[model samples]
Target: MSNSKGRHRKEYHEPKISEIEKLVSSFRSAHGHDKLMDSLRSILGEKPKTLHKAKKEDTKGSAEPKISELEKIFQHFKEIHGEEKLKQSLNEATGRDNQKPHKKDKTKEHNIYVDREIKFKKVKSKDVAKDIINTAKSFYGFVREKLKYKKYRYPAIAISILMGIYLLFNLPLLYMRMNWEKPADTQKLIVKTQETVQKKMADSATLAPGEVVPAESRLIIPKINVNTPIVYANTKDEKVVQDLLHNGVVHYQDTAKPGEVGNSFITGHSSNYWWDTGKYNYVFTLLDKLERGDQAVVYYNNKKFVYTVRDKLVVEGSDMSVLAPTDTPVLSLMTCTPPGTSWKRLVVRFDITDPVFHKPETVTKENVVEVPKEKEKKPGLISRFFSFFMPN
Candidate 1:
């Protein structure tokens, strides 16, 4: 017990001679050396030098020695006059009436608090990658330890791994949907449409007047950032329409093409298989973000038609009435409901507000339709294999 107490207790010692010299120098610097010398002489029973006499001596180039040399003189006097007397004289000269407070007493009298701030540590990319790998390993180890004695441990781990792989492939879709928004510059789409029209006009000489050029048709929805070509499939055949969707949004056959007195049925994929080779696999993934009063533009032939979204509805996948003709020109955008799933059809309807539709007879020469020549191209083995799976 005594050894433990001795080990725990902190021992204290008086200041050494060198430390006292440093303190004396600091005192002399604070209260001029003349005042320090006068105080020391008064304590030592010697005549103190007058300030006027000291100043006169300094003028004559006979200045006092520095603190270092004065300390040596003090040490010589301490040996002759006695150590305790010199210490008392030094304390009186320095104006220190008592010893320093104990460490415990100082701590109790003054409470010191250090504020530790937490900052976000920026690390190198390689270090960040190493941390991620370490975290993954730790998680794997924890899971393995918890499932070690279970009868269904292997099956549980297999399911967990499969789920992880599925999320790895599908998590991007969730992030894309959450952050989707209309581009700030909506006029750029119109500018792009004008450029496409001007370029197509240059190639119009090859086609007859009033005959539609399918390549010139484009659909621009500012809300969803869609500026894709419109593929006019002149048939209701599901297989033919599905194939055309791979190229762009397919415009249903026998329907009013943009600026006509009927609903222009257009369909696109909300989401497609991850391994699908088509560039438009996720073109309409954010189609459900559109609200009423939004705009959809269609560049048909050389004319531009603008429509306002009036309403939206989800119908059964087998619903055919949405394709029915209307007295006023309307544009219907169809995509699979809930994205990635084909349980229902999300149909967004827009009424033509531009050109001020008067009647069916108002259709100009540009509204004349023509069947587009099907350009045959060979598909790869992967594309052909996936094409037989669904109608998307």
Candidate 2:
């Protein structure tokens, strides 16, 4: 019986007293001597009064005795609970060793996540660029294969080149038109130009009865930044009017003059040939920017007439009804549609403010907004060139 008891003691005491001292030293390093004493007191189930007395003694230069008390407590717990159980209890009581593993685990997970995100972003960007290049190559190859036959090859290539050239010439003009800004002095320019025209006409007041003001007429539409002369053409012939457009925007001879009791028809080039010999070739390029209630001021015959836009329309180039007479006085402004092409006509019609031309119709069930459908018409190249000067 005595030999069996000694063997049991040997097995249970495999960890020696030195191991206990080392564990306490490491605990003290991790949590400080004060926390180590508190944890030891907690594990030993010491009374709060006794722990308080010990802390007061520690402040009185008795720390060595307090450490000895902790050592004695450790020895007692070691014998009662076995060495392994005592070590486990110490780790639980200190808590730093258990918490260290969790912190390391969290740091490792964060590093892995960040690395994966960086690698995925780099790979995704490369894949996207490669896919784009491959798609463009495949499209090019497919088009080339379809046009391999002699019958289709030359026409396909010619059309592609022509379209490219057209875009190259027209895109800048379109951009300029879309981004055009009104200058700060645009209003001043309008007032000053009208005054100058009036002063000129007043000086030439001693002319014949049928003579008009000496052709110093100006047209000012503030919305599109237009301040250009109004060119009067004697004839409605397409060729003659086209020639007159080089000087400025043309007013049809048959149409009513500004402030007259009829439609005052005016047309200008939205965009002309690249080498067109005039500053006003691109004057009305942004005419499409006008909306209802916008203003169009015409300085003519020693007078200034301000017209407010009432209706806007985009009609086929072949449509002549827009040029017909109206029951009320109106100012009709015409420009080639889509800026650089003569596909259609964008008309901005305005009601004369003086002597109030727009008679308000009573609101009815039919007064709901109506959107007009655009009619498509493909004018021949000859008509396209003369579309800017279309007759009233």
Candidate 3:
């Protein structure tokens, strides 16, 4: 017991690499390698391991790296017998029992995520292509159905017809409203005339050339019964011209004024859309009806100047020859030709035949007392566009 206590225990013994190499060399040099393998087993104290089937570890799986069939079998038997026994078996199979262990490289392991990602992209692309193809097929089928089937067609046709009727019923009334003319306020004209006549009776005098009096600024054309205000604006704009004409005759702003030396130009619509606004728009329509002896009287400064029609001419719309300055005092009454078209211009030339101050008594008393006999409902052009929406 004392010797046993003083003695040391034998440490663990492993087969040396050099000894294994020498064994493998001797096994190779032996005449009969099978007999040598048997000898090695007896000397090494174990039977040679053989692979009859797959090892348990291969079937069981591992937490570490995925191993091959050979490695799994080697590991299972290594736990059972010994490392040397497995090496001998490996040598018998591969003839390299003394070979060095191969180092494992980190890059050799396959990435499952990378493989899945590639597969996912391929599947996603295929799905997108299928969706596109399906959408096109559905659209084509819908168009074909619409063309071949007549189930929804009659309702569509009915809707279109109803819309057409609605537009037709409202459009003409709309056109009439947009283009209706404003009738003159005969009551206001009568009142103004009465006041003017009263003022004129107080200070009637023969007007000198270029002399404009405050009391007299009336333009009377007895032929057409045109008696309205003369609108003068400093602009030659067409819109201004139209606006002025919409109120009354436009005295061309660039031309000579009344009782002046150059031609005093006066223009009014000969004819317009019967619905267009303005009372005196057709004032000049009857202008051409007047004969050479018919008179146009201008009252200025309580003084009167009478002009006699001399000649009338039809000229192209582009003609500015009639607008030239004349040596004599003249009144050029112009209007659009053929009553409605602006293709040509009609000018009725007038000479200041008899310049005279009218006696106050001769001025018509009936005109001042006159009111329009007919009651006209005149909703102006702009008002008509929105008046339907409002309560009357």
**Who wins the lDDT comparison?**
2
lDDT of 3 by residue, 14-93 (tens): 43445445545543453235544554454446785532233333323232222232234334455556877766654654
The collision pairs in model 1 are none
> Residue 391's C-alpha lDDT in candidate 2?
33
Task: Report lDDT per candidate.
Answer: 0.69, 0.70, 0.64
User: What are the per-residue Cα lDDT tens digits for candidate 1 across 294-316?
Assistant: 99878787767778999999999
The per-candidate count of clashes, in order, stands at: 0, 0, 6
Give me the runs in candidate 3 sitting further than 4 Å from their true place.
Answer: 1-216, 356-392
Specify the highest-TM-score model's number: 1
Give the better candidate number (1 or 2) by lDDT: 2
Ranked candidates (lDDT, high to low): 2, 1, 3
| C-alpha TM-scores of all predictions | 0.37, 0.37, 0.36
Candidate ordering by TM-score (highest first): 1, 2, 3
Output the better candidate (1/2) by TM-score: 1
Off by more than 4 A, model 2: 1-215, 355-392
**Location of the lowest summed lDDT over 10 successive residues in candidate 2:** 191-200
